[model samples]
Target: MEISLEKPIQQEVSVTNTGDLSEIQRVLTELLYVPDDKLKLVVVLELLDYFKEKFSQKDYKINFFYTKQNGNITGFVVSQIDKEYRSYGMKCPTFGWLTSKDFLSCKLLMGECEDFVRKHKFRKIRGPINFPKISGGIGYQTEGFEAPMLNGVAFNEPSSKVLEYLQELGYKKDAKYSCVEVVESNWNKGNNLDDDIVLKFLHPHEIRELRSQILTLAQNSFYSVLADAPGGQSRFEEMMDSYDLVFGNRFVIKDNFDPRSISSIPEFIEAWESCDLNKIVPCCPLAYDRTNGELVGIIMALPNLFQLWSKEPLTHLNVDTVIINKEYAGRGIFSSLQNVGQITSRLHGFEYVEGTTIYANNDRAISTIFPHSTPLRTHYVVQKRILRK
Candidate 1:
C-alpha cells in the first residue's frame, strides 16, 4: 500500500509488511532520541516480537509504512489491529506504538496509518499501546510520557509539530498529565499543629504495625486514585518498592509522650524480634484524644527522591498517605501530619518534598506546603477514534 502527497518534491510513500525488524529498528532509532542503553527499548522490542508471533496465528494484524527516497528507507511507522472488542473498538483501525523524528516522513507515516484504517474498514485509529488487550496486555494510556524523555517511558518526546499536524488532520487532545516538584525548603514553616498531636520515631514493633496499616491504606486508595489518574497506583507501588530498597525504616508521628529513641536499638530488637533484617526504622505521626487515649490519626513518611532535570538527585520526604477517620476532619490532624513530614525530611537530609493530588482534592495542601511551586506538569485523559472498521 502506498500514498503520495503533493509538495515541493511530490513525495511518494509506501506502507508495507516487510517483516524486517532490524530495518524498522534502525529507522526508529534514527527518528527518535532513544538512548542506546535504555531498558525501555528492550521492552518495546519484546512487545513487538510478541505481536509478530501472535499475528502468525491470524488473530492480529501488523502494518508498517515506509517513506523511501530512491528505494533507501527514510522513515517508517508501525501499528497493529486487533479484532477482539468489536462493540467498543474504534471506528477506524487503531494503530500506534509509533515513533519518528523526521518531520515530513513522520507526517507521511501518520497519513499511511489513516489510509490503512480506511482500507481495512476501520472507523478510527488509536494507539502506541504495547499490545492489544486480547493478548497479554502491557501498557496504560497514562503510562507513557509520564517522565522526561530521558527517563525511559515508551513513546516519549514526539515532536510537537508532528502532534500538531496530527491534530490538524482530526486527532484531538485525549489526556493531560503532570510531574510536580517541590523543594524541601519551600515547604510551609508554620508548624502550628495541635499540641496534643505528637511526632516521634517509631519502635520496631510500632513500625511493623504502621507498615500493615500502610499496605491496607495503599490498597484501598488505589481504586479511588485511579478513577482520576489511571496508572498512578501501580506506578506508586513500584516507586515505593524501589525506595524500600534504599530506606528500610518506617516513620510516623504519634500522640504518645514516650517516643522511641534511635539509640535504643536493643529495645527495638526486643519488640520486633521476628522482623525482617530489612526493616530498620519507623517514622510516623500519631494523634491521641487526651481523655480517651485513643489513637485518632496516623501518618507515615518514607524517603522518596527523584532525579531532577539537572540530573541531580533531589531527596525529599514523601508522605505515602495520611489516614484520619472522617470524624477528625478540620481538627488539624492532617496539618500536624504534614508538619511532621516537613520537619523530619529536613532532619534526614532531604532537600525537597513532593506528592500528587487529584483535581477534586481540596487546595489546602498547595496553600500549606507549596504556595509558589509551579505545577511542574499537567496530565490529561486523551482519546482517539480507532480507524479500522
Candidate 2:
C-alpha cells in the first residue's frame, strides 16, 4: 500500500540537484511558454553569469527540484541559499518555479524544499520569489489574470496551485500588497511634482558620461530603505550592472529654487544622468534637492515584455521601486514619482502601470496611493517558520 499523498504511479517523484545553466534554461523553457526570441534567453543567462561572477567562491547554495511522472517531467522549483538570505542570519533562500499544475507534484516538491531547509539549519522559509526585490514584485499574484502578464509581476494567476499548497502547509501571508493601475487619461501629471523641483528625463546618449553621478545618487537616494538589510553591497552591485542596461532611460528632478543649483542644461547634464531634450523621455526618475544639494528621492521602472508571450502584443510598465529621503517623507515625493513613472509610461505607449509590496500597515500608500488608481489584485509572499530542535 503506498502511503505518499502523491498518486501511486510506476515512477515516483524524486529529487535531483544541479546548478548547470543549460539544465536551468531547459527547465525554464519547459515551464514558461514563450517564443525564444521574445524570451531573451541571453538576458537570463547574463543574470546567471553576473551572480556567478559575484559569488562563485562564496558559500552560496543552489538546489533545483523537479517531479517526473510516467517518464515525463511536469513540475520544477529552484531553491538557493544565497547571500541575501544568509545576511543577518536570515536563512531565506528563495524558490523560483513555474506553475505547478499538479497538486501532488507541488506537494512533493515543497516537501523536498522543506527538507532542504532543515538540512541547512535555517528557520523561516520565505519564497517562491523572483531575484532582487526592487525590480520584482516581491510576491506571487493572488488575483487578476484577465489582465495580461506585465514585465515585473511574479505571476499572472496560473500559480494558484502553489498558493493553495503553501496555505495548506501552514504558510501564512508575511504581508499583503497591491498594484494600483494608473490610466493616462485619469492622471494629473502636472500636479504632484513640487514647484521648487525641476524634473529631467535622462537621454540614451548620455549614459557613459554620467556613470559616476548616477551611482552616487543611486546609493544615496535609496539609503533609507536598503540600509542595514542583508547583502546590501551585493544589491548595490546588482543595481550598478542593471543601471548600465537602462542607462539613458531615467527621470531625474533637481531643485531649481536654490541659487547654487546647477540648473543650466550643460551643468544639469553633467551633474545628473537621465535628461535629454531631443526625443521622447524615459520613465525612471531621480529626485534631487536643490537647497541641500543632495539626492532626495527616486522612482524606478522597467518595461514589461511579457506581452511578447501572448497571442496579441500589449504594452505594460512596472513602477518597481520608489524611495523618498527620510527627511522628505511627508512631502508627497514618493507618490509624485509614482505618478511621474506611470504617466511617463502611459504617454510613451504603455497601456498600464503597476507596482506592488506596499506594506499593509503603510498608511501613506493606503490613503494616498490606492486612491490614485484602480486596484487589480492582492499580492503576497508566503512564509513558514522552521525551528531548530
The C-alpha lDDT values of all candidates are 0.45, 0.56
Q: Which ten residues in a row have the lowest lDDT in candidate 2?
A: 222-231
Candidate 2 structure, TM-score to reference:
0.71
TM-score of each: 0.48, 0.71
Best by lDDT: 2
lDDT of 1 by residue, 297-318 (tens): 6655544322332234445444
Clashes (N, CA, C under 3 Å) per candidate: 54, 7
Candidate 1 residues lying further than 4 Å off, grouped into runs, are: 1-28, 34-98, 102-159, 183-228, 232-237, 249-337, 354-372, 379-381, 385-388
User: lDDT per residue, candidate 2, 78-132, as tens digits?
Assistant: 6667565432234465665434757778777777777777888877676656554
Checking candidate 2 for backbone clashes, the offending pairs are 201-274, 201-275, 202-274, 202-275, 251-284, 251-285, 251-286
Model 2 residue 327 CA deviation (Å) reads 0.7
